[model samples]
Target: MTLRWSTLDTDAVPAWAELTNLLAKVDRTEEYYDAEDLAEELSEPGFDPELDSVAVWDGDTLVAYSQLRVSLALTYEGTARAMIGGGVHPDWRGQGIATRMFDEMEPRGRELATERHPGEPFELRASGGLEDDPARPLLSERGYEIVRYFTAMQRPLPGDPLPEVTDPRVGPVTPELAEPLRLAHNDAFASHWGSAPQEPEQWANGMEARSLRIATSRAAVADGEVLSYVITGQWVDRELYISIVGTRPSARGQGLARQVLTASLAAAAATGEYDLVELDVDSVSPTGAGRLYESVGFTPVRTTATFAKADGAS
Candidate 1:
């Protein structure tokens, strides 16, 4: 196999988009990109297209490309981790292209990330459908260990039939209550796995940057304090992604979280904004958030086993 690896340009279209479309036929269990995620990930702030990205080519044919992000992973600590992947066009599979791409990506990820966060060790993170997918096994052979399992759950919102949402305690989020919402978010997610405390300024700036479908975010407040809230992401391609939902410890038993989530989904259904609502939950969480999502019509669509690989391992 003749191979040439080059850095991916942010402005240029990535090969992963088309490769995923082809992979969809072969791997029916996995959901790669729903159009929205593809566009969003490309535009996301942490995405550095110049030094960290790579494209694989064979005789001028665009075979695959890997995208990398350098940041602190919520699931892992201290050391650096990279989220990288590339797809082989269906017609070009079974060749050494994919393997060659992976071999190049690992060292390149280390070089780029180590330069940014000096002296820290670099790590690689990969996710797979966990059901004998070729990519998963290939990664295991590359010294990556499955460290976490994530459940991608979805709730179908077409029929507009939600559980009773009249909890009286739950209502729409407002500008005045943003701070309290942040507090609630911190508290509710604190006990959950990989939860981190983020600043309110970043949170507000995030929602302000895009069409958050802001009118529908729900909150439960009592005694001038926010108890719980659920923020809804606008469905760009018929797939509504729930950005975040949380409830403080003082509010957990009140069923406020469910009410807020129900109300948010109901609103999404009403606006004809999305047909399916989706969110990911840590399977190890003690809060039973997975069950909460399931009870609200979200079924586990796929599992991505997280793998950790030390850079330049022996």
Candidate 2:
């Protein structure tokens, strides 16, 4: 088979889909990215398809892919960062493909950083599952270090009876509540590592994007203030995912998060539309969110570690 490498194009959808299916099969999970998700990634305001991504073909079949995605808004001023996420087909692993992908990505990532924030160092980031993840060694050998660990947790929604939300103001999030919820999110996560305060446009283009419905969202408001919120994402069959959940700092210890999450889950169950709810939490979160999630019946299913390398590292 002839091995050829080139930048990704929209026409390669079939090959990309095949690659993801193969990856999911190898990992023994039903998880797979649909075309909608791909379209959403490509639509990201900061993404530059030609300059930030690559794909490798084996005799006319795409077997490996990579992309360097730079965040337009810096988490910390004077510091620019880009996240690298891609996969090699199971049959194509251990063939230097990952290394080659990194070799191609590092320079492009650095160039974009230099252009965006001159004189600022570029940090290349990637993540891999804690066990049986092929990206781990390639990243480590390239000088990337584990900077954080995150746990993907899930809870089955068996339509169990839910606790009543006593807060009179607790209810579905509406148009008027959007801005306040956004503000609450910013305030809630202010102390998180690597968090950047988002501009309105950025926030809107995110979870509140038109294509994603927020019907399952719930919030707690008191005295015209949003105390906590649970914003949901587009539903995939029977699974409902929470894109963001937070309680304002001033509302901490008021059981607001629990109230909102429980309300959201119960509402989802009431519709008989979902069987599971999922979210990821920082393993060492300062807010002890993992415990909160556990109290709500969410259990850690897997751990993924974020890895970062200095610019120009080999």
Candidate 3:
């Protein structure tokens, strides 16, 4: 069979739900994502659909595709570019199309214009993940380095394990405190690498247009002030995705994050829609997040790498 790889037209790629359904088939699962979920993500500010997509064709059929995000770099390297969602259809494997797809992407990423921030350096940050399956080895051959390991951790449901707490510093979020919790959520994540400070409209616009499952959001309040939180959301398919977990600087050392996480877990378990919860943590957070997660029953499932092709540099 002859194979051809080409740039994908964001609008022409099969709908998100279709691609997701195909992915489920490749992985031996019935799980997949809906279009609205990714449309909202792509709807976010700074999302340029054209410059970030790839597709493969077999005489008139779209068989494989990829999508990536490009953002400013704030790392020691001063500049970075990121790539993700690069996958080959299960039927199309073993032909080296994925590798050629990588080779196919570099020239385009480099020639495209770069955005400059006066005080920050320019860099590339490319990331992609493969399940614990047969195709993972291509990452190394493509010059991708495994700089981070992430766990799609899960916690058993229906039995809430609320930790005993006697501190006057923690409490649940009330309607009046939602705004402050949002602010704290942003500030707490400032120190996290590759994280973008979401816009204020995120809480309302993004959530209201979609099901953010506000019922599961957890928070930690102190002296009538909201200090930190983990904005939680559940999916329609009974899978709980831990959207983001954060703790304000002033509330960092008090185990407030854990308490908030527990609260979110409890809320998720109560819904009876999910039997597990999942979140990703950097392997290198100074906060020892991975260890903290493992201590709470999260186990490592897979690891991913960040790769790059310097501007015209080998």
Candidate 4:
């Protein structure tokens, strides 16, 4: 197939889905994209579809693609991070297509970073699983180095032990409580590595995403304030994923996180709608999130490494 390269166009949505399905099959994971998901990414705050994304086509079919997302981080360095992620079709791997894709991504990322924060420090980051994966070698060859690790964990929900909780009122996540949940989420993750509190606009949009099942998610409330929350969402028909979980710094040690998580898991189990619960946690989080998850029966099933290319690197 003759290959053609172009910036994102309206016609590439289905082709992108096909590429994602191929990648999911190769990685033994569920299909990660649909048209709605693609649309959401395009609509994200400050994203420009044409300049921030690229694609490779085989005649009428998209064979590979990537997106560059720029987000400002409020760390001590006040860094701007440009994340580039995408994949080549399974049958099209090992043919230098990914290199071509990154050729488009890296320069675009730098341009985006400068646009977002002129004369400020920035980093180019990408994430992937497996040491032998093609992206690992490609990123490393491009001066990217691993900076952090994140673990995807899973726990069987059917017949699994659920923890007991007595304090802190826990209940479903309703529309009225969305703002409080957003505030709590921001406060909870403010100290996390490479994280920045979500802008109010971004937080509002996230709460409206189709993937988040607010009715099934749980939140801990105390004195009319949301203390902690476990944002549950349906990944597939058989799996309930913890989209995000956090406890307010002031609310830690009261088991608010555990209590809300248990409520969400027990609800999933009681409905007999899911076979497993899954979540991702930073491996070296100061909050000990990984250990807290392990205590609730979540076992690490996969590890993803975060790689970065520093400015002025080859």
Task: State which candidate has the highest TM-score.
Answer: 4
Per-model TM-score on C-alpha atoms:
0.78, 0.90, 0.77, 0.93
lDDT of 1 by residue, 81-142 (tens): 66676566756777877677777677777776777567876677766655767777777788
Model 3 regions more than 4 Å off: 1-16, 24-31, 59-61, 72-80, 111-113, 116-122, 128-137, 165-182, 199-211, 222-225, 305-313
Question: What is the C-alpha lDDT profile of model 4 across 1-314, one tens digit per residue?
Answer: 58888866667887787777778768654546666667677777877888888888888888888988888544434777888988888779899988888888888888888876888787888976566567888888889899998888999976557877666499888898888887888888888888867777888888888778776699988777899898987746678889998999998998888888888888888888888888888889989988888888899887778998777256
Clashing pairs in 1: none
Error of 2 at 127 (Å): 0.8
Highest lDDT scorer:
4
- lDDT of candidate 3 over 1-314, digit per residue (tens): 87665565545435445756777667533345666665665555444555666667787766777765554333333444444555667777888776676665655555342543333433333554545544446665655555555545566665446565444555555567656866776677677665655555655554554647667877777666677676666554677777777888877788877777777777777678887777777778756777777766667655554554444354
CA lDDT, every prediction? 0.70, 0.79, 0.61, 0.81
By lDDT, is 2 or 4 better? 4
Q: How much does each candidate deviate from the true structure in C-alpha RMSD?
A: 3.8, 2.3, 4.0, 1.8
Q: Relative to the unseen true structure, what is the C-alpha lDDT of residue 103 in candidate 2, on a scale of 0 to 100?
A: 82
Per-residue lDDT of 285 in model 2: 92
For 117-220, candidate 2 gives per-residue lDDT tens digits of: 78776788897656668778878888999989988898898644677787776798888876787788778878887675666766767765643546889999
Which stretches in model 4 have alpha-carbon errors above 4 Å?
A: 29-31, 72-77
